[model samples]
Each structure stands twice: as structure tokens, then as C-alpha cells.
Target: MSRSRIVIVGAGFAGYRAARTLSRRFRGAAEIVLINPNDYFLYLPLLPEVSAGVLEPRRVSVSLAGTLRGVRLVLGEVDGVDLAARKLSYVDPEGASGELRYDRLVLTVGSVNKLLPIPGVAEHAHGFRGMPEALYLRDHITRQIAMAAGGEDPAESDARCTFVVVGAGYTGTEVAAHGKLFTDSLARQHRRAGSGLRGDRLPRWMLLDIAPRVLPELDERLSRTAHRVLTKRGVEVRTGTSVKEATNEGVLLDDGEFVPTHSLIWCVGVRPDPLVEETGLPSDKGRLCVDEYLQVPGHPEVYACGDAAAVPDLTHPGKYTPMTGQHAVRQGKTVAQNVAASYGYGERRPYKHNDLGFTVDLGGLQAAANPFGVPLSGPLANAVMRAYHLAALPGNRVRVASDWLLDAVLPRQAVQLGLVRAWSVPLESSSPETAHAPAWSGHGYGPDGNAAEKPSQG
Candidate 1:
């Protein structure tokens, strides 16, 4: 008898957890293959720390091969899935094409940056989705500060020192919070090195959002806490505001104010990967529709989770689970058990989970958290936030902790590596796991060559 082949696609939080669970359960009884563009699983929650120079890039990226003991790793980006034939086609990193036939398929392909129709945004704004973007933003921030210190033109120096961040969600809030600190450190270092820059002309960070407050989706207390911390740190918190246009000169606010800036970090939100819609599967608002068991309606051999699947929320009637890492992690385990049960190894169960709570790291010993519905703030909240991250991280706990310790005792090393260029990480094509193709291609754009608006997820 031949062994059954189980294929998992896109090793994000959901896919990575699913593969890990299944490998431990099946051991070597079945063939398990994991497909992803990168070899490491990015710990997305801490990506802001990477951009802020609080943590090394490797600290958040866990190795897929080194961790998944019994699973086969396929380095490729899946582009086509033939549900009728149970086969999927993918392109590898070196521009080679490949295909896989599977007895069971798990689709956990995550999301990409949510692009808007704003002019010059796709060209001028930097995204915060993947490692490349994080690295690029760090270098860009450093370069802007370094250049500002030496520039002769006061107007140009001020523009270079001004940073604009759009969106006030988890990613945006963290980015602005950490970014202000990062730029401040760089400016201080420049001054210490005897640069001619003045103390009064500190880097200006403006966080803009159309929403009424930061972390709007989270608890109101978290929002208030974050807003308080940001304002205290000299970050301009611009609520009920948005950008009308972006240009090389700066961004034009919706209120008709042109803010001179060279840095625009776009973190509005994320939509599901284009591959999800390309599957031609039944979808709910661009997410693959699946039952509470995470099984496709007509395809029992196929399952989906993470940001890719609209898994019906059993805990909340008539609603689907939100696209969050907490839900994705639990759903991955549930899907793995259900998949194993399909092979008569165990009994299947429906997915059901209640959100424990959320935490927001607001840079520099300031944090907001509501664990188990108890709201917390300040240094205590910061400790809890770090504890939560360390507990949740799948690997690299020691290294990450060590980095935190080192960052506390030593000054951050802020030097631009000039690794990821600006043109390489276009907003329209910002999925970290996908190959960098032409930005306004047939991927996420509409007939007008602009980003078609879609509902956002985690």
C-alpha cells in the first residue's frame, strides 16, 4: 500500500503550526510536504522591533527545516491549484516551475499589504509586511537621519527628518511608536559624533489614520493607552485624518495640508493573498469559505485556515473568526487533528476558540495589554507584553531574550546596510512569501491599474 501525501502551502503562522502538529502526530507514517517561498517562518508580531533595531532579523525568523523534523520542505511560491485533480503548480526561487500531487491539501497562504487608490502611494510609500520591507525601512530611516545631519538646506533636512505613517492599527501603531524612538536614537548618535544638527530639530513622526483612534479594532482602553504613550513621546497623533495624495515632495493631507516628508510607511491593513481568489473556490469576502471543521464544503480532502480561510466562528454565531495570529495558531492545530482523523488516526472536532486578549508594545518600557480581559499599562504592561511574545514564539526564545537584554544595556547600532532597495518592495506586491513580480500586474490591481478596494483582515 502506498503512503498518503499531505501537502501544505505557505508556511506562515497557520501553515507552520499545522505542519509542526501533523509531523509530531504522524511521525513517518505519512508523507508531509511544506511549501513556502522562504525557508524561515517570520514571527510577524515582532517585525516592528526588527525595523526599530530592538531585535535582530534572525531573532524573529524561525527556521522551517531545522524545526520541522519529519516534514519535507519545498522552497517555492504556489501560483496554481487544481482542486479537481488535487495538484498545484508553483515556481521556485530560481525561476523554475514545479508541481505536486497531494492526497490531502492544506491552504494556509497568508495575506499581502492592502493597497489603496491613492496616487504615488504604490510608488513612493514603503510597506511593512515582510523581512525585506523591515530591513528596507530600517536602512531608509537611518539614511534619512544621517543625510539630514549633513545637509545644507534647512528645508531638505526637515523633510528628510519628517516621517509619515498611515494607518493606526496594530502594525501601524507599533511602527510609529518604535520608529520615533529609533529615529531619536539615531539623531542623538549624530549629535554625539559632533554633527552640526541642532537639538530642537528632532525627527518628527506623524501617525495618521481615518479611524477615530489608534488600535481601533482593539479594546478602547488599549486605544487610549496607545494614544497617550504616542503623544507623550512627541509623536503627532493625527486622528480623523488621512492622506489625499503622496509625492516625492511629501504627502497632501485630506485637509489640504501638504506635509513635507520623504518617508511614508503604509500600514493601512492587509487583504488575503491573490492565490486565494485564484483558487476559484467558494469565498466569503475574498477568503476561502470553510465549515467550522475547516473542511471545504464539497471537498473533504481539502482544508484551509489562517488568513486565507473564512473559518466559521463557532464561539460567535453567524460570524467568522478574525484574521489573527492567535486564532490562526489554534485553527492550525484543529485542522491538523481533523486531517489526521480523516486518515482514521483520531476523531475530528470543530474549531472553536475565544480570544484571550491583546497586547500592544508602545516602545521604551511602555505597553498596553488586556490579558483575560484585565487591562494593564506602563512598565508592568511592557513586561507582560514581552512575556507573551516569549511564550508565544515557537523558537529562538533565548536569542530574542538576549537581544532584549542587550538592547537594554547597550545603545542600538543604527547603520544602513543598503540591502533592500526602494523599487524592490512595491506596495501592490508586498507579500513576503511571494516572488517580486511587476507591481501593477494582473495580481492585485483592477482594470484601471489601481488597487481594488477589499475588506481587510488581521
Candidate 2:
């Protein structure tokens, strides 16, 4: 008899952990297939470090095939799911399409950037969701500083130097905090070369959020610490504020204020991938609805977790778990165990995890973190943040550590790679294949357009 086949979608924090756990439990008893556009699992929390030039982009990506033994890795973006038929359709890297049948399907398809109806935001603002975006931001920041130094008009130079970041959540806060330091360092180098760039009056950075404080969802202590540090570093932190509109020149604030900036980094929160909408499954607040066991209701063979699934928060009674890597990692383990139990291996258990706490890296020797209920700040918090990331990442710890060591001891090497374009990394797409091309080519195309291929093997 053929081995029981289990397919997991979206090889992110949740799906990667699920595949790893199932591979260890089933060994060769079951065939585990992970379907995703990329062959690696990205450690998303450290993405800001990539954008800030503290860590290389590849440092945050762990190779799925290289790390997960006995698990089959399929490179594709799942576009369709036939629930009654128990099959999934996907498009591969080389632009081919195919399908796969599974005994159990895990819909871990993660979230994408959540965009508002703000004018020109979808067209202008680049998001910081994936590796490519990080790379693009790194290059863009370096280029902006370079261009500011060379430009003749002082007003144009100031505009090029100014960076406007929308959203002051963890991602935005981290980006703005680290981004200021990076641009300052770049300005220093330009001034040394007699490039007419002044060291004292360097580029300006503004962080905007609709909440009352930076990292509003985090502990109050962390928010206060982060806000203080950013203020000292000269970051303009505007609370209870948001972008009303975005244009080629800059962003318009809700308070009827317009800021001129060549760089507008959008770190707004994420929503479940649009693919979830195509599933025709029951949803709660734009997320696929799943039971405490991480199984889709009315379909025991179907499981969902991560940012895509609205898993019940038993601890909160009526609330759903927040979209964080911490929760997704734990939920992935639970889903794997439940799937094994369905195969008669063991009894299944519901997923329940208490908040371990949150960490916000403020770049350099500053950070705001609450680990296991302990409020930490300054260098100590930065140490804790670095240690947590090293422990959480699945692979390449040595390389990441080495990069940190170099960044601490040596100056940052600032140069634009210019590989990723603003058009490539939009404010919405997460998966690489779709992010590689324009949004219209991947989703909006009809049958007349060439369809992307499916690269799944069994």
C-alpha cells in the first residue's frame, strides 16, 4: 500500500515547523510534501535587520530541503484548492501548472501586506514583508543617500534625505529606528569625502502610527523605552496618526499634513493571503476559520495554522490568536501531532500557548523587550533580542552570528545593489514567485496568458 501523503502549504514559520515535526514523527511511514514558492523558510522577525544592513538577506532564510530530512520540497505558489476533490493546484517557478492529491492538507499559506485605500500607496509605497523587500530597502536607502550628496539643489537633497515610514508596529518601529542610524552613517561617509553632505544635519526619519504609542500592541514599558530611544535618536514619532494618501513625492498625513520624501516605507500590518479567499472556506475576520485543534470545521482531514488561519484563542475565550511567529511555531507543532494521531500514531491535542512576550530591536545598542514578563531596555535588551533570534532561527546561526560580529566591530559597507525594483516588491505580495512579477501577471491574468507551472513531485 502507498504511504499516507500529507501536503502542507506555505513553507513559512508554521508550515516549516509542521513539516519538520511530521518528518521526525512519521520518518518514512508517511510522505510529507511542503508546497511553497521558495525552497527556504524565512525568519521574518529579523527582516528589519536585513533592511538596516545589520544582517545579510540570506542569513534569515533557512533552506527547507537542506534542513528537513525525509520531507519532499515543492517549489510553487498554490492558486487553487478543490475541497471536495481533495486536490490542490499550483504554479511553479518556470511558469507551469499542476495538481496534487493529499490524504491530509495543511493550509498554512501565510499573510500578505494589508493595504488600505490610500491613494497612490499601492503604486508608490514598498512593503517590508520578505527577503526581496529587505534587499530592495537596503539598496534604496544607500542610493538615496548617495544621490542626496551629488544633487545640486539643497531642497532636492533634503527631500531625498528624508524618509517617511508609515505604521509604527514592531516592523515599522524597527525599520525607522535602525534606518535613521544607517542613513546617518552614510551621510558621515559622504561628508568625509567632501560631498557637501553635512554630518550634524543628516537625513530625517519620521515614524507614523494610528495607535497611541510605538509598538502599541506590545507591553507599555517596551513602548515607552522604544519611544524614548527613538526620540533621542531624532526620529519623529507621531502617534494617533496615519497616512491618508501616498504620491510620487511623499505621503499625506490624516491631519492634512504633507511630508516631502523620496523614500516611503510601508510597514502596515498583514492580512491572510488572497489565496485564502479563493479556497471558498469559512472565514473569520479574513482568516480561514479553524478549530482549537487547528483543523478546518466539517473537514477533519484539512488543517490550517499561521497567519492564514483564525485559530481560536482558548485563553482569551472569544478572541483569535495574533499573527506572530511565536504562536505560529507552536500551532504548527500541534497540527503535526494531530495529523499523526489521525493516522493512529497517538491521541490529538488542542493548541494552547500563553504569550511568551515581545522583542523590538531598535538597532545599534538600543532595544525594547519584555522576555517572560521581564521588561528590559538598552544594551541588555539588545543582547536579549539577538539571543532570541539566534535561538529561534532554524539554520545558519553561525553565519548570522558572524555577520553581527562584523557589524559591531567594523563599519557598514554601504552600496546599492539595485537588484530589486520598487515595482517588483509591492506593498502586498509575500510569496516570491508572485512578488517576482507584477501583480497583474500572477493573479489577474486569464487563460490566454501563459500559466505558471507546478513543480510538485508526488
Candidate 3:
């Protein structure tokens, strides 16, 4: 008999872990294939550090091939799925087409950026989801501060120095917190170099959210701690407010107030990948609906997990698991076990994970955390946060730790590589978590026009 083939889609935390577990358990027993747009897995939790110039991009990009010993890495994005025929079509980096047939399929396509219909936001704002956006922001922030020093108009200089970040989740909070430190350091450097800009004039950063408080979804204790740290770091936290419109000049808040800023970062939440719509299957919200076994109902051969799947929280009875890495990582392992059981290799089990508390890194030696429901703050929280991240990362421990140590002692190395440009990192990218060129050519990306191929890989 031919060897059973298992195809796993995506390479985020869940998909990566699934591939690794299946490769080890099946060994030569099955043909394991992992398909994704990039060759490496992005450690998304540290992305804010990338944007702040505190960590190099490569440090967070874990190579899928290096870690998955028995799996074949196929680089491309799956755009279409034929459920009845058990086949899928994808477009490669060179925009070429290909197909794959599988006996068992794992769908962990992950989530994309969430957008609201605010005016001018699609054109003026940029999101912080993937590697390219972080790189672009790092360079863009540095350039804005440096060039503002040489400009003749003080208003324009202040506008250039000002930054507005939307959403107050962990991503937005960390970006604003670390972002202030980064721009402040640059301002000092300019003054030391006699660039006319005052070192003492700190750049302005405004963090806006429609919620009642920062980290509104987290524990109240965490919310208070994060709010305190951001305030101490000079971040203007605007709660119970939202952007009404975005323009080249600045943003208009719903309160009829206007603020001038050259930078607008959209860190709102995410939805399932667009590919979910093409599947022709029932979905919860936008996510592919799957049972506790991670299998799509009525399609035993199809399994889904991670941010793309709406898996029921058996522990909570009626609730679905939130889009988070906490559940996704454990769900991946369960996917492997269930798939094996279907082949008479092991016993299948339902996905059940207890709620662990959350953690928010506020940059520097400040953080808010509720581990096992025990809330902690200040340096103790920071230490626990760092240790948690180090333990969670699959690889690159030394490089990431070394970067952190260097950042503690030396100033951040801020230099624009000019690899990523403005035209590449648009705010309205169809998939917040993925990148593509404008028109996508044969690749099938959409109308907003982010056509640079360099970003699509990440």
C-alpha cells in the first residue's frame, strides 16, 4: 500500500508544532508536508521588539526546515481548496502554480489583521503584524525623527516626531512603550551630533483604544499595572476613544479632536485567513469550525486548529477558545494524536486546556502578569515574562538572549537597510499576518497594492 500523506497548512505556532509532532510520531510511516508562504516560523510575541529596533528580524524567524526533521517544506501560499476532490492549489514565490493531494489534511491557516471602515485609514495607516512591517516601522520611525531635525518648519518637525498607535492589546501597548524609548534615544543622538533637534524634547506617542482601559480583556490588576507603566514612560493613553478618520495631516478622534502625526499604527485584532471563505464549509464567525478532535464536522479527513479554527473550550462548556498562542500550541499536539488514531496508531482525545492567566510586557524592566491567576507587577513580572518567552521559543535562545543583553548595555543599532519601502507596507493589506506585492500578479493578492515580493516571504 502507498504511504499515507498528511498535509498541514500554515507554519505559525500551532502548525509548526503540529508538523514537528507528526514528523516525530509517524517517522517513515507517513509522508508529512508543511506548506506556508515563508520558510521560517515567526515568533510573533516579540514582533514589537523588532519594530522598536531592540531585536533583529532573523532572531525571531525560526527556520521550519531546520526544526522539522522529517517534514518537507513547501514554500507558497494556498489560495484554493477542493474539499470533495481532496486537493488544493497554491501560488509559489515566482508566481507559479502547483497542487497537492492528501489523505489527511490539517488546516491551521492562522489569522489576519482586523480592520474597521474608518475614513482614509486604508491609505494612511500601516499595521504591525508581519516582519516587513516591523522593519519598515523601525526605519520609518528613525528617519522621521532624524529628518525632522533638519526640516525648517517646527510644526512639521513636531508632526513628524509625533506617533499615534491604535488598539491597546499587548501588541499596541508594547509598540507604544518600546517605541517611545527608541525615538527618545534617536532624539538624543541627533542633539549630540549637533543636528539642531533638542535632546530633551521627547517625541510624543499617543495610544488610542475604544475600550475602557489598557489591556481591557486582561485581568483588572494587569490593566492597572500596564496603565501605570505606559503613563510613567510618557505615553498618552486615550481610553474610551477611537479614530474617526485618518489623513496625511493626522487623525481625527470621535470626540471631534484632531492630532497631528506622521505615523499611524493599527494594532487591532485579527480574523481568520481569507482562504477560509473559499473552503465552502461552515465557519464560526470567520474561523473554520472544528470539533474537539480538531476535525471539521462531516469531514473526518479534514482537521483545523490554531487561530483559524473556532474550537470549543470544553473546559468552559459553551465558549470558544480565544485567538491566542496559549491554546494553539497545545491544540497542535492534540491534532497529531488524533490524526494518528484515525490510522489505528493511538487513541483520539478531545482538546481541553485550562485557562492560564495572561502577561503583558511593558518594555524595559516593567511588565504586568497573572500567571496561574497570581497577579504580579514591576521587575518580578518582567523576570517572569522574559523567562516565559525564553522557555516558549522553540529555538534561537542564545541569539535572542544576547540581543536583550546588548540592548540593556549599549544603545540600539538604528540603520535603515532600505530593503522595505513605503509602497510595500500598506495599512490595508488583505491578510494582516501575511505580505504580498500589489496585484499579486499570478499570486492572487488583492487591490490595495503591496506588490513587493520581499515582504511576502515573511
What lDDT score is found at residue 82 in candidate 2?
94
**Error in Å for residue 73 of model 2:** 0.6
In the range 133-221, model 2's lDDT, one tens digit per residue, is 88888988998889889888888788789999889998999999999999999999998888866546978999999898888788889
Estimated TM-score per prediction?
0.94, 0.94, 0.95
Q: Which stretches of candidate 3 lie over 4 Å from their true place?
A: 432-435, 438-458
Q: In model 1, what are the clashing residue pairs, if there are any?
A: none
* Model 2 spans > 4 angstroms off: 430-434, 438-458
Tens-place lDDT digits, model 1, residues 1-458: 26899999988889999999999999999999999999999999999999999999999999999999999999988989999999999988888999999999999998889989998888788788899889888889998999999988888889899999999999999999999999999999999888767666679999999999899999999999999999999999999999999988899999999999899999999888889889888998789999999999999999999998999888889999999999999999999999999998899999999999999989889999999999999999999999999999989999999999999999999799876656557777835543353346555645543345420110
Candidate with the greatest lDDT versus the true structure:
1
Write the residue-wise lDDT of candidate 3 on 300-370 in tens digits. Answer: 99999999999999988888998999889999999999998999878999999987777787888888899
User: What value does the lDDT take at residue 62 in candidate 3?
Assistant: 92
Residue-level error in angstroms, candidate 1, position 185: 0.6
